[model samples]
Target: MSNIINREIKEIIAYGTSTNPKISLSEDQAFNVLLLQYYCFKESDISKVWYEILSMITDGKDDGGIDAIYFDEEDSKIIILQNKYSNAIQVQDVVNEINKIIATMNDFKEAHTGSYNKKTKRLLQESLDRLTDENEGNVEILFSSLATIDIHKIKSKLLGIEDRVAYITVLNKGNIEEMIEKLQLQHEVVAEDSLYIDNTKNVLKYASDQHKGIFVNVSSESISRLYNKYNQKGLFNLNIRRYIRNKNVDDGIKNTLDNNRDEFWFLNNGLTIACTDFVEDGNKIRLYNFSIVNGGQTTNLIGEYKGKNRDEFYIPCKIVSSVDEVSSQDTMKFFNTIAEATNSQKPIQPKDLKSNSPEMRSLQTLLLKHRVFLEIKRGEKTAKDINIKIKNDELAQLIFSFVNQKPGTSRSNKNSLFNNNKFYKQIFFKRYSSEVEKTEFLLDLIELNDRYNTLQKKFKAELSDQFNLEQANIFNNGKFVLFALFGLSYRIINEDVEISSLKSNSSLIEDDDFIYGPFISNYKEDDIEQKLKDLITFFVNILDEEYTNQYENKKVTSVSNFFKTDKKYINDILKTTVNKLGRTYLYKEFLEYGQIFKRK
Candidate 1:
C-alpha cells in the first residue's frame, strides 16, 4: 500500500535476484534476503553479511514458521521475524504465523531439527541453547509486511500473545518507511538554518589545537527557547546522560535557578557545544552542525524552569568549532575528546571517559590479536571477524570483580558501582605497564565466569522442585557464586607456590607458562574444566545450606533488596564465605587434590 516502501523493496529484490546467477532463488527467498539487508545494511561486507543472513533464513517448505531470527545481545532480547512481502497479506495470515513462532519457541529444543537446513538447524540449536542457559526469556515477535493490516483485528486475534512475550511489534509499511527515513538522515547534508542560538552577549575567543573556542553568556530566556526548539532531537546528541526528568540533579538545577539566580554561573558547570562551522556577528552567533556534548541536564532544567524564574538569570556557554578542515572520523574523535574532558569535572563514571583513552585503544588492538573485540565505546560497531564482543559495562564488572573480590557487589550494583568515585578511581588510575598480560588474564577469567554462569543456570533448571531459580534470592545469586570463584582464583594466583616460582622466573607469567605455572596451571584445558564444574557443584551445596538457614530463621526480609541496598551486608557475606570456602577449604582442595573434588 505504501508506494515508497514498495519501491525500495522492489529494488532490493531485483538486485538480489539478479546478482545470484547460480542459485535460482524464489521470490520469497529473495524477499528474505532483502529483509536481511534492510536490517543489517547492504553496505557491510557481502561475505560477512551473507554468512549471517544465511544462518538466519529458514523459509523453505518445512520451515518452522520463522523467516529470520536475530538475538540482540545488548538488550538480552530475541527478535523472531516473520516476513510477508506481498501486498495482499491479511490479519488471519499474520495471526497464524505468530502462533506458529510462539509454538516453535515454547518447545524449541524438541522441534524437528531435520526439517531445517543444516545452517538453520545449527543456528536454531545454538540460539535456543544460549537463551536457556542464560535464562533470557524476553522475546519480541515482529510481523513485518508490505500491506497495511487492520490493527484492531490483528490485536483481537493476537490477544494473549502479548502476555506471553515481552511485547509484539508490527512493522507494517509505515514502520519500514520510517526506518528508511532515519537511515537517510544519517547521510544527509546539514542545512544552514538547522542550528540557532538566541540573544548571546559578551562573546570572547580562544584557540585549541584545531578548534576555535568562543565563550559567552546568554540570557536564560534565550537558552530556554533554544532547548524548546531542539528539545528531544539531536541538540545534545553526544551527551552521555540524556535528559532524565525529575532526577535529583534536575531538582538541584531548578532550586538554584529559583533561589539563587545571581549565583547560577558559580553553581552550574555550563554547556559545551561542538560545531563543524559557525558564523559570528557581534553578540549573536549562529552555529552549524552543532551538538551539545555537555550540560544536557542544565539545558533541560533551564527549559523546565523557563516561565517560573525572573529574567535575571544568565547561562555560561562555550562553543568549540572546528577551524581546520578534517576528515569525519577525525572530527568525531575531536568532539568525543572534548565531551570526555569537559565532563570529567562533573560527577561521571570512568567508562564514560574511557572511549578516547590510549589504554582502551591498546587493549582493543591486543584483543584483536586473539580474535576478541573490546568495545570501549557504547553502541560502537562490532568487528566482522569475531562473534563475541566485550562492552565497557561488562569490562567494568570484570575489573570490579578482580579488584574488589566481591562479584555480588558488582552484579547487584553494576550501574551504581561504575558511578562510585572510589571504585572508578581505583580501577582506572592504576598503572598498566603490563597491559597485555593483565588483559589476557582478565579475558580468560571472564570466559571462566561465563562457564560458571552456564553451569549455574543448568543446575537451577534441572532442580526446579526446590525453589524458583528465576526468583531474586541469595540462594539463586549466581554473581555471589561467581565472586567466590574469583576469590579462589585471586588467592591461587597470589599464594600458590608454583605461581610464585613462575612469577619469579619471568617478569610476569608468559602466555605459555599459564599451562604449567601456578596461576592457571591446574586449570589447563580438561583439568581446569573439571575443577570449575566441581567448584560450582560445591557452591550449590553451600547455597542450599544457606537457603535452609535463612528460611528457618527469617533473618533477611528480601534477598534482592538486601543485596542491592546494603553493600556492607553483601560485602560481609562475601568475605565470610570466601574466608571459609575459598581461603581454607577450596584453596586446599584446588592445590592438593586438583580435580579430586569431583570424586567427593
Candidate 2:
C-alpha cells in the first residue's frame, strides 16, 4: 500500500479504539479495505467539514442530478467519499458510467447551431451566437478507485475526449527488486549502505497491523462497486432512507425502501390528539401548542415552500402522544396528529401529499424528525458533555399560508387576494348561499360579550327551547318560559359575518354553493340552521380522536371516562367557539375550553 493509504487505514482503526470514537464501520473487513483505498486519491484530504446534516437527500431532491450532496465546501475539485463497508466492485459498472460520458458528448454535439444544423440543435446560445455545446465546458475527471486503479489501464483504455472529460487512476504497489536496481551508490546519498539483512521481517509485520494492513485495500474495493452495488447497504440508520426517498413511489406504491433496515420501523398506535396534549413518551417532540412523537413530524412554518422538493415541505405535524398499538380494521392502528402549526394566520392541515393511513403518514413524520437527546451515566451524579452531529441535514420543506404575497409555483405573479370584494370579487369569487355562510365561519370574535346588549336578549330567546342548556343558562333565563331555547352555534358565538352570497369569492360560490375551504362541504345541509349540526360534529370528532388517545395512552382512563359525564366541564367546553379561520375562543371565563382540556 502507498504511504497515504496506510495513514487512512490507521485513522479507520483509530476510529474504533479512540476514546469514544464513532465506531460505525461494519464488521465486514473487505468493505473497510475498499473505503480506505478510495480515500487515498492523490488529492484526497479528510479534514473537519460540516457540523450537522439536516436536510439530506440522496435522490436529487433539489432537482440537482448529483447523488448525496453534502453541505461542505470542497477544499479542492477532488472529492473523497466513503461508501458501504462491505461493497465489492466489478468492471462493467465502469462501462455503464462510461456510457453516460459518451452520451454527454453526443448531447454536446447534437445541440448545434445557426446554419450548421439549425433545426436539429436543442440549445441555441444567442450570446455566443452559436450553440450550447460550445459553452458547456467539460465532463472533467471523475476518478474512481484512486489508490488501487492501475494507472497503466487508464492511460490505455479508451482515454479519449480531453478538455471535455478525463479519467485518471492512482496506484499502490512497491516493487522492491526494481527499486534496488535504480538506486545509485553515491558518496552522500548511499554512504551509509551497510547491508546487514536488516528489514525483511519488519516488512511482513507492517503488512498485518489491523489498521495499516487492511485499510487501503478495503477502502479501494468499495469505490469500485459504486455502480455495481449502489443499492446495497447505504450509509445511515434512519427511516426516510428506507422509505419514501428510496422507494420508487410510482402510481401504485413501489417498494422504495432498500428493505435493509426494518428494525428501525414498527407499528405505533399512539396518535390521538385534541388541542394541546398528545401521548407523552420520553421521546415525543413538542412544538408550539402541539406535540409529535419525537422525529415523527416535520413543520414547514413559512409554508411558502422554501424547500426544493415537495417531500421536504411536510405538513407540519406534532405528536399529541405516545404511539399506541390498536387492532384497527385488519392492521394495527394509532392516531397521527396534524398539528395546529400556523404561520401568522390560520392553521393548515397536513398537505394531502397522498392519503392518511394507520401507518404510512405516522412513519413519514417519524422519519423526518430532528432528534436532540441527552444521555447520563448509570450511577454518577450530573457531570458530562454532549454529543451532537454536524447540522448538515437542515429541513428543506419551508411553509407559508394562503395570505401570502404570491403563488411561488407560477411565473406570472398571482397576488394573494381572496375572490370576494370582502373576499374579493375577482376570478375565483362568487355569491354564497345563506346555508354555506352560516354559523361556523365567523367574522367578529367578541359577539357574545356582556357589553353587547343584544347578546343578553338573544341568549334568552334562543335558550327557551328543548333543553341542552347549561346549569348557568337556567339561572339567567328561567324568568320566561320562552327564554330557554338558546342554541349557541360556534359561528354565532364567534360572531362570524353572514353574507347573503359569495359570488365574489369563488367562481363556483354561486348563490347556493357554500364554500368553507373543504371542511364544511363534508356535510351539505339544505337549511342554514342545520349547518350548525355539522360544526358541532366537527369539533366533537376532532376532540374525540386527538385528545382521547393522549388520555388513554397514559393509562389515565379516568380522563377518558370523565368526558362522558354531564358536568360543568361540558357546559364550559360547549361554550367554546371558532372563527371561520379556525381560531379558538373563550366565552365568560378567559380560560378557553380547548386550551383547558387539551391535555385530557
Candidate 3:
C-alpha cells in the first residue's frame, strides 16, 4: 500500500510546486493542489488488484485540468471527478462543470461504438445508437478546497446534485484522524488494500501571499487515478496558458498581480498561488505610483522594482517564455539574469539601457525599437558564452517585462514558420496515419477549407469595401495574408483589383491595377487628387493578357526579413512618371506582419 501511495505522492511532488524558493511557483502550484489527495481502503480490499484502473480524457485546451475516471475494473460502474484548488470556491461553478463531463463522455462513447467496418458496424449498431443517446453522466464530483470553506452553502448545492454528481469538500483545518474518520462515514468506492503515507508536512510553505501547500478538498482516489492516467497515456503535460485562456483582460490582471501576488512568487500570473510571505519585495511594497498623462491617455508608472522577496526584485529570463524556470543544469549562454541588487532594485526606465557587449548592443537596439524583449545581463559572456546562472536571473525580468508590455517585440519569434509551410502543403500536410485514406481526407478537407476561407475573405472585403495589393488573401479571413502579399507584389485580373503598397521611396501602379496609398511626394504642387483617381481607373482598364503572360507564374517568396525572392518582369507601363503624393511604407507592414506571423 505504501508503494502505491508513495509512488503517487512522489509523482505529484515531482510535477507539482515545491517549497524550495527557487522553483517557478506558477508551474508548481498547479501540480501542488493534486498531490495531497489519496484513496483509502482497509488493508484487505479484494479488488485492490484493480487499483491501477483509471480514466482520463485529454482536453484540447492545455491547462492541467485533467478529468479523472476511477473505477474498480471488476465492477460494472464508473466514477468521474473534477478536482481543483483555489481560495475562492463557487457552487454554481461545480454544477456547470458536471454538465460538461456528461457532454464529453457522450461524445467519447459515440466515437468508440460508431461505424468501423461492416461486421464491427453491425456489432456496434446497438452501441452506436445507445451511445448516440447521450447519457446523463453520473460522475461523482469531489470538489476539494484548501481554504476555510463555507460548508453550509456547499452542502446545499451538493444536495441539489444528489441524484447525479457527488461533492467532497476538504477544508484546510482538519486533523488526519478527523479526515480519516470523515472518509469512513461517507459512501465507499472500490479501493485497494495498499494505502500509506510517511511524515507529511501539515504546513505547506508559501513564499509570501498565500497558503503553504495545496489543500486536498478532493479524494485521494482521484489523485491516484489522475496520476495513472497521465502515466499510462504518456501525457506530454498540459501548459498553463491554454487553460488560463489568454486575453486582453488577462494582461491587465497580470500587471497588477505581478506587483502583489507573493513575497515568493512576487509576480502575479499563475505560479505560487499561495504564500505566507517572507521578507517582501515588489509584490510586497505597495506602489502608489502613477503618471498623469496629458488628456485621457493611459498613464505609466515609475518606481524601483522593490524586492517582494528574492523573487520580485531579482528575476531571471529566458529569451522566449514569459515564465522563467530556475534550474542549475540548464546553465548555458542565452541566459539574462537580473542584476537587481546593483540597480537598487529599480524598475527599468526608458533610460536604464546602456551596454558595451555586441550582443548587448543587439538587445539594446531591439529594446530601443521596443521589440518584445529587452535583456541586459552582467558577467561578460556573449549570448552563447553567458553562464547559465546569468541566464536564469535575467529570465525572470524578461518574462515580467514582456508580460507587462503591450504587444511585445516581434523580432525574435520563437516558433518555426516557413513561408510555404513547405509551400503550405509541406508545412501543413505531413505523413498522415495512412497515406491513401489520410491524403484523400486531407485533400478534400483542405480544398473545402480553402473554399470556405476564400469566400469568407471575399465577403469581408466586399462588406468593408476595402481592397489592397495583397495576393490571394483578398478572399477570406486572410487579412494578414493579403497584407503580406500586397506589400510585395501587384496582380491584376479584370475587376479583381490587385493592390500595391509603397514600402520603399515609391512605385507607380501599372496602367491597369488598383494601387493603394503611400505614394512618395516628389513635387510641391502635383495635381494629387485628380492624378490618383486617373491612375486608379487607368490601372483597372489596362489589365491585359500580355501582362499576365509576363508575370503570372512568378511567386513572391519571402527571402529574408520581409524581403521577397521572386521573378517579376517589371513593366514600363507601371513606371510612368508620377508626382509622388507621399513616401511609401507598405513593405514595412509586411516586415512587421512577418514578425507577428512568426510569433503566432
TM-score of each: 0.45, 0.20, 0.21
Model 1 per-residue lDDT at 316: 81
For lDDT, the strongest prediction is 1
Candidate 3 segments whose C-alpha is farther than 4 A from its true place:
1-11, 14-37, 40-66, 106-138, 158-160, 165-600
Q: What's the TM for model 3?
A: 0.21
In lDDT terms, how accurate is model 2?
0.23
The true-structure Cα RMSD of candidate 1 reads: 13.6
lDDT of each: 0.58, 0.23, 0.27
Per residue, candidate 2 scores C-alpha lDDT tens digits across 1-600 of 344434544654554444235544333332233333222221122222111110121221222121221211111121112222212333434334444434533553464222323211211111111112322231222323323334345444544633243222222222211111122110011111011111223221112221111001011112122212221122100112111111111111111112211211221111211122122222222222221122211111111112232221111122222233223321101122122221112212222211243222332222223221111111112222322211100100000011111112111111222111232222112221232332222111111111123433444334333223222222231111111001122223223323122112321111222223222223333432223322323444433343335334632222212232222122222222222223333222222221211110
Q: Model 1 over residues 1-600: C-alpha lDDT tens digits? A: 566665655665555556566546565665666566655342323433554465467676656788877655434456677888777888888888898877776655455454555434444544553342233456677788877777657877777776677556676676566555444443222223332334444578898787898877766776777777664445665664444333345557777887888888888888888878777775567777777788887887787563355756677888887888888878777777877777656465457666777766776776677677878876567888883577766766766664444465566556555567777655554433355455555556556556656665655434344444323233444565445444444544444224433334321211121221123422435665556655545555555455445534644323333333224334434433444443455657645423321110
lDDT, candidate 3, 175-254, per-residue tens: 22233332333211112211111113322222223112221111123223323433112111111111111123333433
Off by over 4 Å in 1: 1-201, 244-246, 324-337, 340-477, 485-520, 523-525, 537-559, 562-600
